[model samples]
Target: MKAVVLVRTRIVYAATAFAELVLWQVPKPVVGCTHRFKYRLAYVVDGTCVLRYDNEAGKGDHRHYAGKERAYGFSDPDKLIADFQADIARWNHENRHP
Candidate 1:
């Protein structure tokens, strides 16, 4: 199997708050995904994880928010980026406690 890193990025929202995004592509089947791509996104505040998205081997795709984990649909890469950013924006609006 061939793997490629598509994106690796981090954005700072504040001195103690930040978000990171990592996207990867695989040409063949691997752990946790039948899709050709996998990604992980996370938002942290004051060293605490508040939001995350990832697709682990045999687990498909999922998201975590406010310490709760939920299944997430894995669509195209653009949608993934949009969703991650939207979640961070929502968190910023709701309870940006840091």
Candidate 2:
């Protein structure tokens, strides 16, 4: 997976050919703007996504599985999306016709 920050805003883009999914997550300003922050989570499965903001209580928590390997992270939404796409691309390249 790959991630990049643009203009202080994190953007993640992902695509999975096997699953026929593409995802994009964009960061937004948190309300109240204290130490506590919130991120809008946008995920696309089979090219469609539902977005929900992470509450303070559930700020960063998620799991991803690639084949038999599992990865866990408390990461920003954008980063996660980018990583997902990169992994899918890499997997497709390695396992499928180019």
TM-score for each candidate, following the candidate numbering: 0.89, 0.35
Kindly list the per-residue Cα lDDT of model 1 for residues 1-98, writing each as its tens digit. 57899999999989999999998888875476668887889998899889999987787889999778889887788998899889888888889453
- Backbone clashes in candidate 1 total 3
Worst 10 residues of 1 by lDDT: 26-35
Task: List model 2 lDDT by residue over 1-98, tens digit each.
Answer: 23223323333444421232222322443333322234333333345432222333333433333323232353554565566556545544665623
In model 2, the clashing pairs are: 14-85
Q: Local distance difference test, per candidate? A: 0.86, 0.38
- List the candidate 2 regions with Cα displacement exceeding 4 Å: 1-66
lDDT of 1 at 80: 88
For residue 1, model 1's alpha carbon misses the true position, in angstroms, by: 5.3
Over all chains combined, what TM-score does candidate 1 have?
0.89
Stretches of candidate 1 exceeding 4 Å from the true structure? none
Question: What's model 2's TM-score?
Answer: 0.35
